[model samples]
Target chain A: MKDPRLLAVCCPDWPVVAACTATGTALHVPVAVVDGNEIVSTSAVARKEGIRRAMRRRAAEAMCPELVTFEHDPQRDARFFEPVAEAVEELAPGIEVVHPGLVAVPARGPVGYFGSAEQAAERIVDHIATHTGTEAQVGAADSLFAATKAAHRNMIVPPGRTPEFLRPLGVHELDAPELVDLLRRLGLKTLGAFADVPENAVATRFGGPATRQHRLARGVPERPLDKRRPAPELAVTETFDEPVERVDAAAFAAKLLSERLHENLAARSLACTRLGIHARTENDEELQRVWRAAEPLTPRGIADRVRWQLDGWLTRERLTSGIRTLTLEPVEVVDGTALQLGLWGHDDERAVRALLHVQGLLGPDGVLTPVIDGGRGPREQVRLVPWGDERTPTRNPDHPWPGRLTRAPATLADDPAALEDENGREVGVTGRLELTAQPKKLTIRGRTREVTAWAGPWPVDERWWAPDRHRAARVQVQADDQAFLLIRRDQRWFLEGVYD
Target chain B: MSRSATASLSELGVNPASELTSTTTDHATGRVLPVRGELAGLLPWGGLRRGSTVSVGGSTSLLLALLAGATADGCWAAVVGLPQLGVLAAAELGVAVQRLALVPRPGSDPGPVIAALLDGIDLVAVACPLPPSLARRLTARARQRKAVLIAFGAWPSPDVELTAESVSWNALDDGAETLRRQQIAVRSGGRGSAGRAKNVLLTFGEEEIELPLVAGGPDRSDEPADAGPDRADELAARRATTREQPA
Candidate 1:
């Protein structure tokens, strides 16, 4: 069998499992986890007290009474780690997530591209540590399973020893309940055991499943490279094993539903930009809410949205007791792209999100792409817009945009002396225009500058349309010497953009 | 590494040779015990390598550091007495805390617990309150599995590795001056069999760095003390805390 890249992940908590399943790939690396404080990992006392890995918190406590617990955020762990995965992607093609704790990537191209598999693995580990703020160990091998085992083993498998490396690992590394049980029944405890078993007999005993077990033991290919495709973006509806009533039951159902939804998304490289949730009560009534993935579109974010949707739908909407079924749909798709962290391709998603917003506002042709425009003024010469749709990139494509001389300002002073340069020397913002230095009004230089060319109060009414959809007040302003366009949205005045 | 095998074997309920080979078998030879099989690997002796006591003086960062590398090597290690070991810290540190034991104390006496571990257990930590005598005994038992015994400071045992002395390179903030995480100014007693040693310069990144004041000597060569296996300066400058004596 040819060598297949293996990505091994170890997610000891349910949140990790939920996150992993959402992403679709069998691999993941948890940055931080919720309920980590309570896990009774391998320890002298833990062994004596009879605790086990992947045991429920309550079960672990039962084994060793008084087991203290810690509640951490898995979302934070996922959020923190997307950068690492993105960083690794710089070295290879798309990552194939095996679990929330593991991912398998093709090694030939990366190794050959970088001159050697060892160097690539080393670079990946270093990049992840520096770019994503998480310490990771990367191993490359001919097979996905072998690679996963090697990674968990923390020994970067030299190109040739993948099969030899896997020989010693136990079969349970597969961690699939029924498969593991069958293998155990056959006394095939280790990869060596499966490797030693006759392929024909093994298949006869475990049927089809055993063949996979054999191939994995031999470092065989499981799946092809991760092809970014638009799989069916669908809704998941879960019915209780037993019909459940009560708001708590409904909430629990939502949690389960959200976990399933996230698992599907994670497995397929997809994220729902918009969501619509529905609950079927035991009384046959339905409670539903049309929502959005909100900010960042994380599993926790989705869960929060579900809870918020439930709260309003249940209390404000006055839905009565007990929900029998719950369904969630990914109404729209956004770039929810996997993160790339590091110098190679570590572009911040916040920047992407901002660009997406700009693109949405100005049709594709209305916005211009980011171009390096070096200019002397405060307004940046760089203009970013929706790709292909020509809004002509009217936004300044010049360096040192006015008002935000550092990042691209909204309004500029008649005289540069009025700018605030407190920490300017370091950040390159050399002006000292403290606009609010006195009252709500300020003197730019000698002349008092007031609001000039205006737009909003047009109340360009938004969600005027969707309730709670008003994000900010976008006021297009143009002063004489300085052209200013400001957005007084969400109570703060940010130069929504500049039109120099 | 043997500890993890033994643990998994035990988890699978597989029984093995019921005898302790001479003090040199790479993995411990024994009957697999029915436990979650926590295999925080031993140093190939029996328990924690000496000089492994990290001062858990209430800082979460330090506490997590203590259990972070419990399984850096493929060993089955168990922290018996330290029940309050932070789970999140351990997980983040790459230590699988799912099999940890939350015991008030391992046995009626720390000696018996040590004996149980020494009998056949691979890398079991019996967390009794640390005293010099208890540290010595626990350290004695750890010699078999080459296990690491990291006891808390409230039980300050003289025998364990005082890791803070080795890794802290920066100066300390005291009345006289301040210290960085990269260097520490040492004060020694200069007495005893270990010899009179005073004012030792302690540098960071060393395998083991003691305050150089002990009745016997130092044991800072363990892998966990200085995680970087690539430092020679760390090997040459190791000093025993017992070397500190009254001149």
Candidate 2:
């Protein structure tokens, strides 16, 4: 069957452009966006200076010392791209954002209106450049995958010619790294080579995901775009008694609405790939946009999209009032059997639901899960992340940190305390790790106790190069039945933890 | 009377028959989450019984220890309203930290939050004090959901109550060694099978605690302490073996 022709708009290095636009950095300046330690995207100027994607940040900096770098934030990129998507939507309605940098629409409406596919692409690209002041390329082909690839090269493949256009592309264009590597090892270096393999043989050798990629290689849709029409009741709407004027408020509402939408979809064993967000302003202005993804949207993914969209709308000067009504509707769905509960069993699902319920009651940051992180202090060693957020630790735990405590206290305290010697003089640690007084009495929160046992002053000097350097010495002292970890900093002793 | 004859007589009376059937069914289907080492002997049921409230008083380490075995056995546990909880200590005590969630500061009213957690989590340990009415309601909720509710502070009418009577820190001197191990004496008492007061000695070493495997008396000498992760694995393996034995 012939796949439906689609038109896709692509903005090269959108992250760099969005970063530049958000920070008001001129486009001529060399800029790169980094995720963690690696560069994700670079502006044209940086690319000219040999800064490539996946290059280490230090290498990029070493190559071009004047290059400005910004941490890659998807929400910021999406917020900046909203104007570009809006520009295209003015020329052609029913736009579906493939991601922050790309948007796709059915070619029939734009081509029929513009009289030719080339004219439609030209008009959309010109409209975006004029309205949003961003350079864009438009491509038209039989499938979204083919259209996206064509847009990257600014080409419009003629009707029924997508297979020819995709034939010479490298297998890396498939975007499945492992599958592409295996195909390259098997001498299928190009998409055409991979596509030439027999369908039954490919299905037997390769698995389900590979089969879908094989379809994309052959210029066929990965699956028949069923675009199931979700039940009207599946659309979740929330009417704010006090209109949401702040981004944080909207984000909280988005999390709740997305959870409800996901629950409704999961009940029917469906997952949304395309979502439509609708909002009504207090002044009776209505606004809407649609977002599409290659895979089904998880709850967090849906919430992020809603938040980015709302942030774009709320921050822009077009809206005169706050949003009064918000709605989330699944535009396209698919069988969600793959999204079923994990092998950990049904209790996990129930627990997740309960946690989500509490999150709804007390906001997302209310319920948290702990991750053991790398640090010298007990409080710094454990990072508490919100229930549904990523559980990645900020610092790597494997690095051997000197002067760390051998045993962690069962409880942590931040109370102010006084450590004094028997002579009634306050004790202190000298700069050379010398204690001014050996014997001491501990006074904590108005209660004084005699110190029975004592330990050394373990000094920690961190971030000595920066202006906010911290220099503190820790001591373990036992007073009566209680043992406390005390830190002497800025000439005062404060209780850090309790070994209960 | 013979067992068969008593059963026949009960079957002749409708009320007695239904009551007898309910009691037998409840006993047969009662689920118990495993506890670690010798700690099991302190509880009447030899484990944490589902739908029962167990309160731990005066010891945060004991509360964390109670959650370790069940979490390692694949049970989800959550702690509510204890912001100062030492998660690192919990990890060192063999709790599967990944399966544990913390609602550290649930604000002034933590009743709804704890109740919601009780609905989903297999075991919930709450340190916040709640009103008597809310506490009773939460207990009923836990019972309905077949979850274990662990109260950290004073609670009314719990199925089992554990208190730390004496605690001593080991491996510390005037100026030499650091604080390493701890010895705690925990006393348990409650209603029903747990009504009789019992005491157990738990030695918390650097990595994992040494609990006496036998219930005779507190034996603190000569038993080697295993590392935290290996002890968890051993407990998980033992649980698996126990589960398969019944099948």
Tell how far residue A425 is off in model 1, in angstroms.
Answer: 90
Model 1 — TM-score against the truth? Answer: 0.28
Give the winner by TM-score.
2
TM-score of each: 0.28, 0.69
Give the clash count for model 1. 137
lDDT of 2 by residue, B16-98 (tens): 22222123344345478877765766776667888999999988888999998899987899998899999988987889988
What TM value does the first chain of each candidate achieve? 0.38, 0.73
Kindly report the docking quality category of candidate 2.
Answer: acceptable
lDDT for position A106 in model 1: 61
- Model no. 1, DockQ: 0.01
Tens digits of per-residue lDDT for model 1 on A349-415?
2222322232223222222232323331223343333222222323323312211111122112222
Per-residue alpha-carbon lDDT of candidate 1 for residues B156-181, written as tens digits (9 for 90 to 100): 44232222222221221111111112
Give me the iRMSD of candidate 2, please: 10.4
List the candidate 1 regions with Cα displacement exceeding 4 Å.
A1-3, A6-51, A56-59, A62-66, A70-77, A90-93, A224-500, B1-247
